[model samples]
Target chain A: MGEAIVVTSGKGGVGKTTTSANVGTALALLGKKVCMVDTDIGLRNLDVVMGLENRIIYDLIDVAEGRCRLNQALVKDKRFDELYMLPAAQTKDKNDISPEQVRKIIEDLKPDFDYVIIDCPAGIEQGFRNAIAGADQAIVVTTPENAAVRDADRVIGLLEKTQIAPPKLVINRIRPSMLRNGDMLEVDDICQVLAIDLIGIVPDDEVVIKAANQGEPTVMNPNSRAAIAYRNVARRILGETVPLMHLDEKSGVFRRVRKFLGMG
Target chain B: MNGKSSITIKGVKEGLVFLLDDQCDFVTLLDELHAKLDKHEQQLAGPLVHVYVKLGARQLDEEDKERIRAIIRKQGNFLVQTIESDPVAEEAADYASYRLHTVAAMVRSGQTLEHDGHLLLLGDVNPGGTVRCTGDIYIMGALRGTAHAGCAGHEEAIIAASLMKPTQLRIADIISRPPDEWASAEPWMEYAYLADGAMQMDKLTHLHHSRNKVLQAKGV
Candidate 1:
């Protein structure tokens, strides 16, 4: 059976949808059959991010309510034949679906795909519960901001209470220049606070917004740093050992000099 | 009337002590107090005299104490300083407040862990997390959250952490200075406490030296 992975962050606007879209696209590019599920319900945006918004005929709610078959609700990605997306209903709220129904849907989808990527909603309410219901593993996305890190810690705590394995962390939108200036929280600091394995780190790139605005996942743009980060994350998910990308070479030199001077 | 007296008045440096008979009935005690006050009306007609009431083994509720205050008010020259009773049985909640609870889980953001007594945590307290205790709080890991020791108004309670980088610290009702003041990370473990009604921080090594009783082990 395929492994179900849920992408979530307790706070809103921390790149949960973007991470889901990019990671799913990257996995498909790696020759794996992938199904992306948008569990945000009324606030669904994964379809738009994956450039599949125009093709959705039926939605997740319709499939769960038995109004349509699961295959009927899936929208095919334009670039990859192996990648499919199950859109959320724009009219339905998160309370409309129960965790058991979500679990059932994921179970049915698991047999056909190698990876089922569930994009979770922002809050720790019903939507979060429904998204994690069928997830065997979880990826907690967070930014370097204090509020985002705090929320990610809360999400990790909640995930630990579930049957899913300990969640991996993805620190997104890091600004290397700000990090060098000592204005942003360091990657080590975020890791120390969350105390979870770091799966990937995506730097702050303007191309992410540009690609998303064009209704394409950032991973489709090979030149973007965020795209490479997502691809590395996908490789890690496939059990490949990839070294963490260097955020900045100057910061490394600065840190080494400080250590040499015994001022670190 | 029996020859033995039920109420005795003694003069001390600070005030006049009224030792009430604990074995007597409540109504009888009140009557005797009234009679004694009336008999000594002339002696009580002087400058304001502090009166201290001592109930050896008796417990008086709020209404009963008010009654005693009213009776003493009849002697206009007397000021009721205090009314005290011997120690009584403690409630279960109070007893639980003296316990030490050890927890081995991280207190995550938006999560609060409260204990009736002291709290000993084995994991980090992430930012936005809260830990409240009636006594003291001892964190074996980093404390990046809010910690409130002596939540029940114990001024002597303390909070100690291996890495003291908390967002906020409170001892009893006194809050610490802003997070900016506590931004630096000291090399050694540190603790926060209330000293002279103000919150203060120091190395954990000096805790026993400052508050000798804090390190004393409880007797079985």
Candidate 2:
């Protein structure tokens, strides 16, 4: 059976859709047939991120409502033969979809794909519930800001109640330079607060924004640090043992040195 | 009152209150009533047996009512008592004491929930929403939000739900996270409680088993 994963972050603008697009693409690149579903409904962005916005004819709502067949609504990505995108309906709101309907759709799609990645909408509402309805696992994306971490923490708590097992954490938009200067929250700090397995630690990168604007997820670019991190996260999802990159090695050394030198 | 086996338990109220107990098999009760009517056939020469077993005109909660109804169903339509008031009063009292308390329509940012009692959330507690309750936290729906139970440090506090996932969890400081490799998609009713100074989860497969056993053993 295919793995149905929801990329959710209770807080808005925390790179959930971005992570979904990239990770879905990455997983597809790993030879896993992947389908990315945009569950945001009215405020859909996953299609745009995957550069498949203009190609969308039938959306998720259309398929769920039986306006179109599931296969017909699935928009194939130009980048990978194994990758498909199911755009959300911009006209219909979150209420247009039900959890049962979403679960049915996922069940229908599971046998055909290796991974069903859902780009969950911001906020814990009808949209969030729909995205998670049939998800086998969840990836909670969050930034390092207090509000983002706090929101991530809350989402984690919510996921626990689902009895869906613990959702993994993906800390995106991290600034290693800020961490070096003691201005950013470290990965360990986030892990301590969230108390979940760290799957992805994406550094703040302009490449990601540029790629998103171009309708291409940064994971396609092998040079981008954030892209590499996302790919690593995808590998982890596939049960690979990839080691975490040292984003703040220089600053970590300085801190150790400072602690070693107890005297002036 | 005029019937042979009619036990009339009275109050200021109108009609008879039927007492249902688990002491004898329901067949035995009905058979005894039938036999009593047969013995007094001359005194009460009615074709049908009218054996009214009245317990009392007592109010009960929904749970108690369900229990009573289950027993009544097992007895199967022989014993009939006219209740002066609706049996619903007991349901009202029971529900009033433990009606699920759903939080505000939205659990917004920077808000913390510290409830001494059960927390029934109708909506989601978006990320950054913190809840610390002394009793169980029941999110009627999804709980991808953070919740900490046993805040007063009660280890007995259970965190249960239809869908469960939390970022950070502490059941009386016995901190444990979900298995890193667990990504199963099943709608399960799971409870987390402190076991051996650690958090443990168990499937709530026996909803009525525990209470039923206790009641049966207590001879209630």
Candidate 3:
């Protein structure tokens, strides 16, 4: 059975949605039959980021309410051979679906997919609990900002409250130049504060916004450094030990994409 | 006044107000309304003006309102603005809709909050979320989403947010822009309204209901 991993960040706007889309797309690109679920009802972006919003006939609510079968709500992503997404209902509130209902929905999804990465909404509310309810694993996305780190710690405590596996951390939008200039917080500082295992450190790239505006995930962008990092995170999720991307001040990102993809 | 007059049409500062007689048969009321507007069709042609239908205490069938709308359209280029019931019935409607929904959580993208009357939100309305209400909307947190107040075409409706940076806001029949104009106005709770075919944003504390007594109200 495919393991369900939830991408959550207690803090808002720290790249949880972006990480979910990229990491889930990377997993699917690695020949896994992957399904990405948007548990962030009301404020959903997985389908829009994946460029599959128009294909959604039924949604998570439809499946939970038995208005449609589970497969009927899964929108197939033609970007890859084995990728699909379960979109959240745009017109519904977060409280409309309970955690128990989500658990049952994921239970039905687990049989057909290899990796079910759920894109969770922000905050530690009903939507957050519902997103984490069905996951076998959790990936907490955060930035090096102190507020984000504090929220990530709180989220980690909440995950432990539910007795799931130790949550992994992905420090997104890392600005190495800023860190070197002593303007931004370092990855080690965030890791020390949050006290979680590091999964991925994504660099701040303008291409992410550009790709998102085009309705494409950054993982598919061969030229993006964040894409390479996301693919490495996907490998780590698959139990592959990959070194973190070294942020060099001189060579920067000129010669990394070829070297990153050549290894796979 | 015509002997069979059941529809009273009068000009006001806002536009035109029509009072539908409560005792008249629905069909006769509609017939008189159509005839009166058709007689003045030439005078009511190009410029679209607001039209309010006052139905005292009687609640007509919803389809009856639609038929009235069709008759108005067939006669002139008037926009049916609001259909207000009697004061007692309005009080009862308010009581029926007194369950003011409050979402004590952050509203995220693809989510929408809809209520019949006033909607009170204690969380941030993030981008991609939408909050709509037929009455006034009060957001205790930042409103970065799309908010449509007075969605049922009540011109007197207002939207107030603690930190107002909405993507778009609508009050009554007017849609507002200039979200960036008030980026510095977030710290102050802001409300929106429509004046002279354009949206006006002001501090919530200064929001005044522009209502008058029935006769003076009729002049407006």
Candidate 4:
């Protein structure tokens, strides 16, 4: 059976849905049969992020409530032959579905796909529980802010209590300029607080927002810094070792110059 | 003689000692005690005399103690100061407060690991994570979260961590200054404690000077 991964962050507005969409897209692009499940229910955004919102005729609640079969509810991503999207119900709240139902849906999808990426809702409530119920692995997304890091730490603690493998952290929305100016919390600091393995670091790039506005994942644009980070995270999920991208803009030029001189 | 009393009364310096026979039935003992007090009513009527009742091997519940107290109250000028049993009840298993509990797991944010006694954590206390103990708390890793040592009103409790950057530190009832005031990059394990009702911080090595009991060991 394929593994199911949940992208969750305890606090809201921490890019969990964005990470889920991009990572799922990257996995599909890497020749893995990937299925993205939106467990956010009433507050679903994964469909919109994947640009599959208009194509969704049946959703998670429809399949859960036996109104439609699992395959019928899965919306195919026309861009990638291997990618699929299981949109959440817009009318039903998180409490409408139970963890057992979510687990069953994930289990059903796992055998048909190489990877199941679940987009979790914010907060440690019923929605979060439903999202993680069937996940074999977890990705905790957080920003560099103290509040986001704090919430990420809380979510990590909760994730540890679950059967999922120790959740890897994805530090999203990192601003290298703010970091250099000492105005933002460093990646090291966030890692120190959460005490988890770092899976990826996506910098604060305007491209992510622009792509989202167009209902497209940033990973579609290979030149975007955030896109590279998400792709690296997907490769890491496939057990590939990729060096972290140089986030310091000035240091990249300095290091390139030093390498070119070769001490001459 | 078969008519012999099962209760004996003696006068000590502080009070009157009533030695109740353990072998007799409780009802018989109470009857004999009442009779004895009634017999000495005239002699016991002087000043307000303290009465101490000793139950040799008898376990008296609260109701039984109240019954005995009521009987003594019936006797004029007698105040029941103490009602004790020879076999002391085992103290509740509060040994947890004295024992050191070792946990080898990260205390992540929004999670609280509480111990009745001292806590020795092998992993980090991440921000928003809390580790509370009735006694001292020792962490082998970073403590970026909140550590409340002596949570159960133990003012002498101390919280020590390898990396002492915590969101908040609480010892007993005293909370530390805001996280800004405690921001330090000193590359030494540090500890926080209450001194004179105020929070104090110092290097871990100097802990022995303030709390010698922490290092002291008693053996047979």
**Decreasing lDDT order of the candidates:** 1, 4, 3, 2
Candidate 1, residues A230-263: lDDT per residue as tens digits? Answer: 9999999999999998989735544553465466
Rank order (by DockQ, best first):
4, 1, 2, 3
Location of the lowest summed lDDT over 10 successive residues in candidate 2 chain A = A255-264
- Lowest summed lDDT across 10 adjacent residues in model 2 chain B is found at B88-97
Highest TM-score scorer:
4
lDDT string, candidate 2, A175-250, tens digits: 8888878888878877765767999898887778989999988998876777888999999999999999777664
Per-residue accuracy of model 4 over A126-173 as CA lDDT, tens digit each: 999999999999999999988888788788878888899999999999
Which ranges in model 3 have alpha carbons more than 4 Å from their true place?
A: A249-251, A254-264, B1-220
**True-structure RMSD, every candidate:** 13.6, 16.3, 15.8, 12.5
Encode model 2's per-residue lDDT on B155-197: one tens digit a residue. 6667776666665566756666665523325567776666678
CA lDDT, every model vs. true structure: 0.91, 0.74, 0.82, 0.88
Model 2 misplaced regions, further than 4 Å: A249-264, B1-220
TM-score of 1: 0.76
Q: Which candidate leads in DockQ?
A: 4
Order the numbered candidates by TM-score, best leading. Answer: 4, 1, 2, 3
How many clashes in candidate 2?
34
lDDT of 3 by residue, A1-264 (tens): 889999998999999889999998999889999999998888788888888888889999989999999988999997887999999998998999999999998888899999999899999999999999899999999998877876776687678668679899999998778888888888886765465799999988777988898899998887888899999999999899999899655334644544554632
Q: What is the docking quality class of candidate 3?
A: incorrect
The CA lDDT at A26 in model 4 is: 97
